[model samples]
Each structure stands twice: as structure tokens, then as C-alpha cells.
Target: MEINQWLNSAWFWVGIVLFIVIIRDIFIQKSHTITHNFPVVGHIRYWLEQIGPELRQYIVANNREELPFNRQERSWIYASSKNENNLQGFGTDQDFNSPGYIFIKNAMMGYNPPVNHPSKKNPGVLPATKVIGLFHNRKRPFRPYSVINISGMSYGSLSAKAVESLNKGAQLAGCYHNTGEGSLSPYHQFGADVILNIGTAYFGVRELDGTFSMDKLKQKVDENPQLRAIELKLSQGAKPGKGGMLPASKINQEIADIRHIPMGKDAISPAFHAQFSNIPEMVDFIESMATETGLPVGVKSAIGKLEQWEELAAYMAKTGKGPDFITIDGGEGGTGAAPHAFADHVSMPFTFAFAKVYQIFQRHDLTDKIFFIASGKLGFPEKALLAFAMGADSINIAREAMMSIGCIQAQKCHTNHCPTGIATSNKWLQAGIDVTLKSERYYRYHYTLVKEIAEITHACGYEHPCQMTMDDIELSMGDNNRTMTLSKAYGYHKTAIAYEYFNELIDCPHLGGANARNRLSR
Candidate 1:
């Protein structure tokens, strides 16, 4: 082609346009140092950085190398959610010799329920052995139908479709869904029982000035029959002692309406509750809420200092008036956006934190009184078993539930760009989730998880997971092939309170409906 003809060609015109745009971006855009310094070539670096997580997840990293949720863990959840074959062929890839390794001590003769057992007929329907608020005599005390329930992941932090799917799934699976600290949005009303999590800002039941309002709380409870309980958020695992701030830019009208906050202004949650400053006052506040709402009241917190927990336990033991349940969140828990330092090092991990708090309550003889809930990565059957053995009456799962509904753990939760639509609120991104289909997926995941836990329980000669004690667990000490009982390692002896409760229920004719034989299945 002639030089004049080349200059007038389409390719030549495209090059000219690109060159002009690049020159303008290089000089005018000072926000990105690399692009400003290296011009068009630096664009390649940003693109690579943008997709770095995907490349590492799918191509570079091994199955177990990823953080938060590795390929193996994610695969198990995905397969379980889809009701696919999740059984491993070549045994575990775990390093048995590794220090801190834990495993359940299977009984020589596995437990076999009677042919007429509810579990045999309905598989995966393990109900709580103890009622949630029976001890407190709340106006509406009831036993939780499933031991495994969905943990809190706020509607604002997650998409509306995600919340709706989770609620529907919880309903199908006979499990409760936690309306996270963001408040009770319409999406959380899909016929599932809800534990309303009231954070420091008191989102759903807050006054115009962001203070907690008892009248508003009563109205919420009265309006939503599904609001079975309330969880006062003292702190979360991801950011202990740190309050949250929802940027005005991310606060849409829906969020503003749900949270009862004005739009176009930052919604700030202070580090501490304005209602109570000390343990006694906090107990009074909890009791007041329980009285007003006629529902069980609980507190969720990540452990740091021991003094506050000890004080709370001591006070509760003395007065017998406090939270009906206590949920211990581990430092490893995620879902909320947090500072790197706070997320990594602020609070104790679940096992250690739970041990400390459990010991404190045990010392006060309050262990059997309050419903103990465990959170933070207790999704898998083995992990969940360990938690129950450590004295957890129930377990809550957040990330695992999100994964079941289509989260790839892209870790873009804080960026409003989740690819699978579980985390992000962006309409285009959220359109990826089919509420009905994903809801079924979540149901399958929950049902399968509870079923597997029951299978493991029966293998361990136990009727229910809560009946397990630390004596049934062992951990490697990282010494010369040394092993230690979980009870000894944690420096506490877990009582057979749950087992005793199970026995009592089985003995009573009227309460037989709550027994393992009549528990929900399938």
C-alpha cells in the first residue's frame, strides 16, 4: 500500500486515536503513579494486578495454598451445595504429623439409631438439645430446629438477592437466618426465623439520632413474627473494638430505609454502646430488651481482654439476669471490611477465645444456663464437630453460606465488585444470582452439612453433636509425636450438660417431641 493510502486506512485512524488518548491519560491522570510514569506500558501492570487473585486461584496456586478458603475447601462447599459427590478417593491431603493437627476420636462401635429414628427417616435434621430461652422463661421460648444456622452478613454489605436467597434457604432447611447488624430488611422476610443483630448503631431499631429505641424495637418484633431473637453486637471478629462506617456513596435509598439513617451522610457506629457502659448496666439493658420484645436476647463479641468476660459471667451467675445466649466470634472470621491490623491480630481465634469464655462461664456455673453459639470458620463437619465438643450448643456459618449461594471468595467483598453477586450491592453484579436456584443451593448445602455432622456424630457414638465433650477430641502438641486431649490442652473440663438435657428430654413423654427420635429430618 502507498504511504498516503496507509495514513488514511482504518488501522491508521485507530492508532492515532489510541495515541492521543494515551498521551492525555499519561499527562492528565496523576492519580496512578505507574501509569503516569510508564504511560501505555504501565496499563499492563494494572490489568495484571486487577486479575491477580483469579490467576493465582485458578492457575498458579495449589489447592491448599489459598487463604481464607482454599481450593479444596471451596470445592467441598461447591459440591455439597450442588448435591454432588464430595467424597474423597485417595484419603486426606492433610499432614498428620503437623503440629496443632486435630481429629475426632471415633468410637469402636459406631452409634446406630433405631429404624424408626427421625434422623433415619429425615437425615440431617438435628435440632438443638436445649431450648434457647426456656431457662429465662421468655414469653416465646422455643427450641431451634437446626443446630447449624446462617450467621449475620448485612444486607448493605451483601446484595438484596443474596439476603433473599439465604432467607428462603433457611426456611427450606429449617434453620434460622441472622438479619445482620444492618437491620431487618424486606429481603430477610422470606418465611425464615430471624435473629435480629443490633449493632452499636442500632440500625433497625434506632431513633433519628442513632440511639436505640425500645418502642421501635417492640414495633419491629411485633410486625415481624419471624424475629425470634435478638443479638446485640458488642463487637465482631473481623474488627474487634472498632466501629464501622458505611460511606454515604454506598448508602442507597433501600439501605437508608432499612437502617433508618438519612442518605448522603456517613453512617457511623461507635465502638461501644451508648446505652450501657459496664457489665451490670449491660445486663439490665439486655433484660429490658428481652422483656419488651418477648424474645430471647443474646450478645455477640470477639474476645480480647479477660476481665470483662469474667465480670459478665460473675454478674450473670449472681443475678441470673443477662443475655439468654452468647455468640463467640473468632479473629479469623471475615465478611465485614476491616483494617488489616484489626482483622489479623485484634481478637483471639475461635478455639482459644471460646475456651477462655467457656471456662469463665463454667467457673460461674453458668455454662448450662445460656445458649453458647460459636462462629468463625466452623463450617465443615469436622470443625463444627470440634466446636460442639468444646461446648457450643449451636454453630453459625457466614462465609460458607455465601459460598453455597455463589461466592467465589474473590475477596472483593469490600470493593463492591463481587463477581458471583453474593457480596456486592451493585445491580449488574447482583443480577448474576438467581434467588430461587441459589436458595435451593443454600438449602442443599445446609441440609448436607447437618447430615454429615449427624453421620459423624453417629460414628462417634453420639445421638447429637452437642452431646460431644472435649474428651472425645485430640490435638497434636507439635512435640515428638505427642498428642493431648482437647480438654487438657484448653485447661477446662466441659460438662455433659447438653447430654444431660438430651437425656431429660428423652425421659419426658411430652418433651419427647424434642428428642432425637422425633427431630426433623430430610
Candidate 2:
């Protein structure tokens, strides 16, 4: 009687129907070779493959084995953001003998600040040693409160909540936030100072014919009081010599409105700017923008061929009409999406690229006239210090900042299905992010990073990071346990002007650096 009832049950019938449907679909699916060949068993294989990354992240991969960012790196960022103890118990697991390993040469006596100094009380209070645009004398020249700032990330590239959290956190952390080439959105107005990045598309300041519109640019500058400077992006590290693309799936009404583009179509930026064809014309364009807005103008690019850079530096030295700052993006930099070849092989890495550019400007005696900002994988203390020693006045962080605000390195940024709600436009995915909570995390992460960098600066016997020279670092040569000083390795030599501002800060007690210290004391 029990067997007869089980055979007639609806549950059994439903299972039978499901099995038949799955088997039929597997055999008939020509799109997937495995599914067609192996039928039902192949379904299991596909499911496991779909979750392979997660399996490796949580179980299979060792702490140092992961690419882009290792498990150890992610843990440090997570702990810092959560305000938890970030100290490691055992000695470093790093293979000290490996090539490319960096070692900081500590001083016999670390820098000791005055007993009454504010930095002595809160190490995170360290400020930039020099004022941006002071040499150029922009009408609105100001010192960036923190040497570390958020990097360019467009509104369309990030979810609304992510943008809101980053801007709000920038305000809390006393760092500037860059509004990337996708254009400014309401989410970026959360009390943070803004650096508007103008890409080849000129999304925010473009005419109907896709040409530069000076009137529109002026309007944007006038409308935003917190707007500090303008960055003209020639190319980013991720895909140098290529344009950016925003897929149609990520485009919403708000994005369309902000970018001034039509809906239901991919937004493509031109590979080259329509405003200027050559370096001289580019310089003139930068000057015009600065004059129009009374703000500092800068250029950002990834290193490629050397002739253009040499020409730019020579022209700037001869004419004195170049950008107030220059940002060098490393080839290792991240992006929402890019072609594999360009991302892997197009431009030079940050360390090499920056050295070359710095040397060029140094030869021309133009290093001091412009601020040098570096962006790559420089969020950590040692890396940031290396950048500073390499002549970087300030450093910008993007992927690390994203991790602070809940990115899991899922690498699904281009798919519009980001598990962490950071790089997605879907409402359901976005709901996972809590603006208030993530903003605080970002603040903590920024504060802790700056504080740690200050600690490293003191350890190297320097009161300010700008005082660090290439002589303070050594890199392993990966042979016979050999090591070489950065100065010897890269032939890097800092010009007299490189230390001019730091010397002035030391001599003048009423300067901006001292004033910042006084403000912190109060």
C-alpha cells in the first residue's frame, strides 16, 4: 500500500519532469561543448567552474599566491577599515630573498617631533609638505590637507552608493576626491573637495557635436565651490592608447543625463582629444582652462613612447606654459574593463615610468614647477614611501579604496553583476551597500594608511615624506641575494628644487606646513 501511494505522489512526478527537462537541455545545448558531450554530468562541471574563483579565494589559494591583490593584502585593508588590530603575529611570510623585494633603510635615530607637536599626539595629522599650484600661482592655490587622495573613478563605473560613500569618506578623512571622466554626478557632492578629470570625451563640458566647450567648462567650475583643480587625462594605465567604453547594460537614465548621451547605446570615448593634436597645442589648452577658471590645471597619462614626453618637457621648460601638475599612471593600474593585450603590455609600470618622467623633467629643470602624483598599487606604507622617494608629491589610490568600501576582488566589474555592490548598476546588487557604514570604513582606511605612512617617514629619519630620496631604499636583484640602491639602479637623481620646499618649510615657521601643524594643535 505504501509503495503504490509513493508512485502516485506529486513529488515524484515533479522530480521526474525536472530530470527529463535538464537532461534534454544538456544534450541539446550546442553553445557549451562539455554540456553537449557529457549531458547531465557536464552540468555539475559547469556549476563548479562558475564558482571556481570563490573556491580558490576562500580555500585553495595560499595567502601570497593570489594575483592583483593577495589574501594577505586584502586582510590588511579589511582590518584597517574595520579599526581592528592589523598587526601580524609571526614574522613576515614574504620571501626576503626574492627579486624586486623592497627594503627600507631605517635611520640610526628616527625623527622625534617636538613634545608639543600635534603629530606626536595623532600621527595621522601629517599634511602635505608643499602647497599645490603655489609655483604657478593659481588664483585659488591651496594645500591638499592629506598627501593621499582618492583616485579617478567615474560615476558610471561605480554604483551610486559607492560614489556617495567615497565622497563622504573623503570629506571625513580630509582628502580630495576625483570626479573621473564619466562626468560629475550628484553623488560626488557629499562634502569632499573635487578634482574634475576631463577625458577625451569631455563628457561634462562638451557640445552637441562632441567638441570641447569652454563655456560649459566654466559653468561647471562656477557651479561647484569645492572644485579645486582640473585634470586633463590623456590616457589611463589600464588601457593606454585606447578609449574608454561604457556598456549599454550599465547605462541608466541618470547616467545618460549626467554624461549627456543617448540611452540604449554604448558610450565610446575618442582615442584622441579633438581639442589638440600635438603637445604644444595641448599646453595652450591647459593654460586657457587654468586662466578661465583661475584653478590649477594638470595632465594625466600612462608612459608609452619617449619622444612625446621629451618634447612635452622641453616645450614646458622653454615656454613655461604647461600644466601645474603631472600624474603618472602605472601600467599595472586597474579599470572597469579593458582589452587583455593593452592591460598587460601597453605602458610602463609605475616605478619605471615615473623614474623616466622625473628624470626628463629634472634634466629640463622643471621638476619643482609641477606637482608629481603617482597612481598604481601604492596604497601601502612602503609602496607610498617608495613613490615619495621617487619624486611623487602625492599619491592617488583607486582599487585599494574600493576594497576599503567593500569590494571583494570578485573581478566582475565589467559584468554589471558585482557581488559587492560596488561596480554594479543593478538596484538589487546596490542595496547591499550601506552608505553610512561604508563611508566610515573608508574614513578609517584613509586615516590608518596616512598614519602608517607618517610612521614610516619618521622611521626613515624624515619629518616629511618629500624629504625622502632614492638613497633611502634598496631593491633585491634576485641573484646571489644581491641588492641595489634605487639611485644606483634607476640612476635617479633629485634636483636642488626637489628639496627646496622642504628646506623652506624647515626655515620658515609661518609657512603653510607650520600653519597646518598649528591648526592641528588647536
RMSD of 2: 2.9
The local distance difference test score of each candidate is 0.87, 0.85
Error of 2 at 522 (Å): 8.5
Give the per-residue Cα lDDT of candidate 2 at 152.
Answer: 94
Cα lDDT tens digits for candidate 1, 74-158: 9999999999999899788877767778878989998999887767777867777777777889887756778899999899888
In the range 1-522, model 2's lDDT, one tens digit per residue, is 998999899998988986885777666566877766676678889899999999999999999989889999999999999999999986889988888899999899999877966677766665566666777777876566678999999998999999999999987776789999988899999877789999999997887557888999999989987888899999999988899889888788898888878789888898989899999999999989999998889999999888999999999888878888899999995854788998889999999999999999899988877889999999998999999888898999999999999999999998888999999888899999999999999999998998898888888898788888888999998867799988999997665333444334334533332133343543
Error of 1 at 85 (Å): 1.4
How large is the C-alpha RMSD of every model relative to the true structure?
A: 2.9, 2.9
Candidate 2 local Cα displacement, residue 30, angstroms: 1.9
lDDT over C-alpha atoms for residue 444 of model 2: 91
